[model samples]
Target: MPLLNSPRRMSHSLRALAWLLRYPDDEMRAALPALSEALHDERALIAGRLVELDDLIDRLAHAPALRAESDYVELFDRGRRTALHLFEHVHGDSRERGQAMVDLAQTYERAGLLLAPGELPDYLPVVLEFASTQPQAEAREFLRETAHIVRALFTALLERRSAYASVAAAVLDLAGERCDKVTLPEEPSLDESWAEPEAFGGCSTQGQSRPGQPQPIRVVRPQPAATRSAA
Candidate 1:
């Protein structure tokens, strides 16, 4: 399913990569072949990079369904280090992240796409979907803008020896960013990830509490401080 070597061929790699990063539900697991086809057909990733992605695909496809799902939850839902939410890496829980979330969602609306309920705009899969809908150059630029976050995730995944690192590497290749080994500092626990800044109010994230429970991110905004001094 190799793509025709035309300069103008719209690459579906962005969406494919997004699919690779999603929660491995039954539907997604069944789409393995199509997902693999798109990655090769797009020809956006080099052969070496394709090999890495193929390896990840094989691991995910071959693992038991529950094992695959649990593994994904453990790897991505454990801490902020491997967070799929891009803003977590860039802005943590500051007020700026909220505004960025709004701006990104508005951008999606302007492009005629609406997010499903419970979807966050900065989620890697959602961001990639938006990029996939854009013109080729625009899509590349979109990936380029987020390459720093993508690369950090890559390093974090690599540290844990997760197959997901391959997907992040492919993303880096697509963005024309360098994909080399990097050392990321340790990731904090869910409680530690919620540290409040001295200047701004804090944000809190709730991760999985029990084994096999999928990690879902919820941002808790602090109550506003009273502006009046002892009136």
Candidate 2:
């Protein structure tokens, strides 16, 4: 199987694993390292998206909301966690970059720019500042090695998107599940359904709480109804 294929499988698995981990599933906890490999794929995918998005941000520089800073932060945090996970699982111990990745991920949470659209000029500097603080020697080396892998992945995704007729016909000739083409939604939106109680146990949002950051645990509160007046 392709190396890229593993990440796609893992991404689907991790989404489910992230939700499962919240509720003290011991078996799942034991399985997290294996699950985290899914994130390795996710990180690679995000890196590709980042390269595209960085250029896209420059091209679509019309307004702040055009490419939300929150989206950048979200994508960064997800990739950061996966990177940290790879570090820990591989090292089997803590190290500066692993901790730094966690720290940066948490620092991002503290900023909390998801809902509020802010000026890109204002936030881009902040992102650059954070990036500058990263272990560039390490991250740059890793990025250089993975650049081609990510490019191939994105190329596959683009082909899957644009030349679906030819792609589908080619895949259909192979005589399997037809390798159905996966298309993204016309308008993608965050899954707020996780906000519902059953979906997320405490905090509805995805991703792990940055260590030492305040976690938002939902508390049920009742509000008084308006009293009926003369009809």
| TM-score top scorer | 1
**Residue 38, candidate 2: how far off, in angstroms?**
35
- Looking at model 2, residue 215 earns an lDDT score of 67
Q: Residue by residue across 88-169, what tens digits does model 1's lDDT show?
A: 8878775779999999999999999999999999999999889889987788778888888898999999989988998888
Q: Listing every candidate in turn, what is its Cα RMSD in Å to the true structure after a full C-alpha superposition?
A: 10.3, 19.6
The runs of at least 3 residues in candidate 1 whose Cα sits more than 4 Å from the true structure, single-residue gaps closed, are 1-10, 194-231
Worst 10 residues of 2 by lDDT: 167-176
lDDT of 2 by residue, 1-231 (tens): 122332222223224222221222345344444434543444423443323333432322332442443433343233322221223222322354456545545665555532224312112223323322334333233333323322332334454342112211211211112223343223213354222334444333233455446666689675545433322
TM-score of 2: 0.21
Candidate 2 Cα misplacement greater than 4 A, ranges: 1-58, 62-128, 133-136, 142-192, 199-231
| Candidate 2 displacement at residue 29 in angstroms | 44
